[model samples]
Target: MEKVRVLIVDDSILVQQILTQMLDADPLIEVVGVAGDPYEARELIKKLHPDVLTLDVEMPKMNGISFLKNLMRLHPMPVVMISTLTERGADITLQALELGAIDFVTKPKVDLSNTLDKYEFEICRKVKQAARVKRESLAEQYQRFAHNQTQKPAVESFPTTKVMPKLSADAVIKKIAVPSKFPKTQQKVIAIGASTGGTEAIKEILMRLPENTPPIVISQHIPAAFSEPFAKRMDTITPMKVIHAQARQKLETGHVYIAPGNRHLIVEREGTQYFATLNDGPEVNRHKPSVDVMFRSVAQACGPNAVGILLTGMGADGAQGLLEMQQVGAHTIAQDKLSSVVWGMPGEAVNLGAADQIIALDKIPRTLLEVLTLLN
Candidate 1:
């Protein structure tokens, strides 16, 4: 098998070194070259012709975002971001994703050497995933991204390869009892889960939704620093109010609740009302805000009153939970492979007979709204 060739672009010598080492450690990956800036990276790209590029947000000569814009517009390919775990970093990383990055790895803030093992797994896995992104799929995303950029100059919106013990949803929340009883409440709830290409996918769906749509709960794999900004960003573009989920927060019509990155967001029913609850439990499917946890909770709390839509992402985090939702008679949808940047999650759901409908990214909003109409 040909190793995935990678080019590292960072201004810091230490970062370039660390990234190179981490990527090289993976037998499936090879560091073809390293560049200190975008200008140097351009020259290296022409020579090395790497399969993927690891980019840093901060760099001299030209910032990573600026370089990324030029690269995507002129020569689109797989690119993964190296971002810090700060508010500003989160914002810039989100912007990079909108611009066409396949994925990202957060840089360690403290005790760098100590975290290299964990960081190694994350960076290597993302690079490999980025390399696997179909060129046609990436071109489609860039075209959409370019179109969105022209409309408004703003942000937009994977997977588990972990060295640590991979735990299932049971590690965090128990599975629903057999022959789960449907909740008596007739009010409907919408639950969405995604990872790799989810931020933008979720944004596409949310922006198209009517202001009067049902209560929405989303679980997108993200870090603690990024989820708040992501919710705020969605609030600006979408018609509904987007909020970071808080424990015991009431689910309201025309409002969206997003799980915080560090905690699991679960839906619980109290009498006739549904409330969002946060769980600080062990990571499920290698994600704190695991989609399985949220989907499972929704299945238990809302049953047939719920709608589960698994969007573009890597890995199989939400597949079983979506199946649970389906078994309870909830309408389920999965983003089609051609429309998904990485079809791992939604594809898994489809394979498990979880989705009632399979729709493209652009048509999901319409399909979801139609489902909402019938359910109501």
Candidate 2:
């Protein structure tokens, strides 16, 4: 089997060498070249033709963002950004994703040496995942997003220095599922799990849903400090109120609760009512906000009254949990392989016989609405 060729580009020679060594150590990967800046990277890209690039966000000659934009516009390829875990860095990193970068890895915020073990694991994983991304698919996404991005509501505007709003677990619960509160005993729930290309996929589902949708609990793989902005941004575009999950907050219809970054969001019940509960325990499936945790919780809490939808992502985190939901008589759906950005998660569910139905991404919202309406 041919090893995946990778090119490392960063301002620091240390970073270039360190990342090169780490990626090269992976038996499935080869370090084809290294560049100290985007200018140098541009020349090497033409020569080395590496399968993937590890790019630094901040660099001399030209910043990563500029190079990323030009690369997506002209020479589209799979690139994983190496970024710092700061507010500004998070914003740029998200922009890079929007511009068609496959994924990112954040440098340790404190004590770099102490963090290397974890960082090395993630860097290798992301590079491997990135290599699997089809360049043509990224080009399509870049074309798809370029226009819709410009017309978003001003409330969703970016780069704000203002204090991001405090999001309690149920902060936006008013008038969930409709203009009226859902009956506690009969309330239905929806659980969604996604990663990789999920940010855009989740947004599309939310944007299409009516204000009368059931209470939604989402576990999207995102870094700390990114989920808050994600929930806030989702709230602005969708009629359904979006809030970050807090411990033991009641789950209500017409509201979507996003799990806080780095914490598992679980749905639990007390008597007849459901609440969004936070699980800060050890990471499950290598993710603190693991989709499996939330899916299993929803299965236990709602049973036949729930719907589970698994979207495009890179791993199998939600596959077994979706099967749990299926065993409990819950209706389960997986995004069909044709529309998936990466078919790993949803595909696993399909193979596990977890999905009751398989549908395209654009069709998920309507299928959900129809299913919920029939149940009601």
Error of 2 at 115 (Å): 3.5
Per residue, candidate 2 scores C-alpha lDDT tens digits across 1-376 of 7899999998777677678778888999999998988888999999999999999898887889999989987899999998888877887887787788888888866665556557887889888888887888888777766756776422221112322132222221111222122234678899999998887789878887877677999999999788887787788878889997877788887899999888888887777788998877666666768888888878777778889999999878789889888887789999998777789999999999999999998778877877776665
What is the Å distance of residue 311 in model 2 from its true position? Answer: 1.5
User: TM-scores, in order shown?
Assistant: 0.94, 0.85
What's the lDDT for candidate 2? 0.81
Over 74-135, each residue of candidate 1 has an lDDT whose tens digit, in order, gives: 88889999998999999999999888899998987777667756778778888999998876
Best candidate, lDDT: 1
* Each model's total of backbone clashes: 2, 6
Q: Where does model 2 exceed 4 Å of error?
A: 110-114, 150-186
The residue ranges of model 1 lying beyond 4 angstroms of the native Cα positions read: 110-114, 152-163, 178-186
Q: Candidate 2 versus the native: TM-score? A: 0.85
